[model samples]
Target: MTANSLELNPVATIQSPFKSRFGIPRQSGLVPDAIGWIEPHAPWHRAEAWAGIEQYTHLWLIWQVHDRPHQPVSSVRPPRLGGNARLGVFATRSPARPNPLGLSLVRLLAMEHQAGQVRIRVGGLDLLDGTPIIDIKPHIAFTDCPPNSHSGFAQNEPERLRVDWSMLPHDEALRLNDHQRLVITQTLSLDPRPAFHDDPERVYGCPLFEFDVQFRVENGTLFVLGLNPFP
Candidate 1:
């Protein structure tokens, strides 16, 4: 390895409903019902490695930025700024930086050990399915939660667009359970359309869990066209 570089191995893999990046929330902790888990690999699956871990209610996940990790960009157009102005990559949390790493604070729901295999259940996550987890750290409120922090351009949470699932057939709607419904609604509320690409007549398809979510946006409202099982 180079002097400034180091090799790292993924300790776990994330199992999340977000199959693709199209509909994932821009930030973590936005969707409370977006449940997922981290299954440790090989030697990391030992129970002793997770001793006393249940004491913490939340954790910080250090993961890879998947698709964007291989690409490099010096500047980026932030969707929060209407995608009109470009800012230095370091100024914003764009995944196209030199080191494509992502950090998310997730609520720990459970820690299970079955036959020496370990899984960490978490909620309010924004990671995609099969994302590689490099490290996990407990959330320390005393030091991590800094008061009076400025958000810069993103002064407030992204506005949620009103969603209309009326177009979905009764039978198809029944396929989604309560948790799935919340995940879908919460994911759609953020308006997953690309910032620079706003085509009211265009149909967008997002992969959520095992279903292909089809929808369209018109006049600030998102209409669910259909939900088809992933073949």
Candidate 2:
């Protein structure tokens, strides 16, 4: 650390369907239906600071890894490598870093003023609810697009899992709105399983919007069994 290192304060808090990190997509923009918002704090909430922000269609969010509070290790086992092979921390986006920072590119959906607060709705975020956002910047297509970018060991996108909502009961199915339904389906289809485990009978639950969704994987298919109100 340098003597001149500066401190940073959260400019906003994110409101997203992912209450827990268990089911969130590994990267941003993978779940197009996953919606989220940023509620600016205090001075940042002033409308003048956000004037003309709506003109941009996408933004880059620099945020804290709120869930990764433990000390960072020099290397990590990436899930893409079957949790066996190790890689330097800098080479992987493992969330456990020396500074514990995260970056995401999300599409701006809307900007709203409710009462005295400023809310910016966004789509394609993989962030957890209440995550602290440190900064937001417009994504400039002319400068941000790089022709030399490469995926490294992650040569291709992971195969999507098959989600079968047939097991979901009528009463439970009725609880989800169209948006929530799409979010859940898209999220589950990504097979949020840890790369190390593939227990076919293990039931998992994750918070989606206002509901606690329960499901299991069987024969390579994710089955939505039920849902309960998020507590």
lDDT tens string, model 2, 116-160? Answer: 668899999899999999999999988998777788998688788
**Candidate 2: global Cα-lDDT?**
0.89
lDDT of each: 0.89, 0.89
Q: Evaluate model 1: give its lDDT.
A: 0.89
Error of 1 at 211 (Å): 0.9
Report the C-alpha lDDT of model 1 over 109-162, residue by residue, as the tens digit.
998889877899999989989999999999999999889988889869989999
Error of 1 at 21 (Å): 1.5
Model 2 regions lying over 4 Å from their true place: 1-4, 114-117
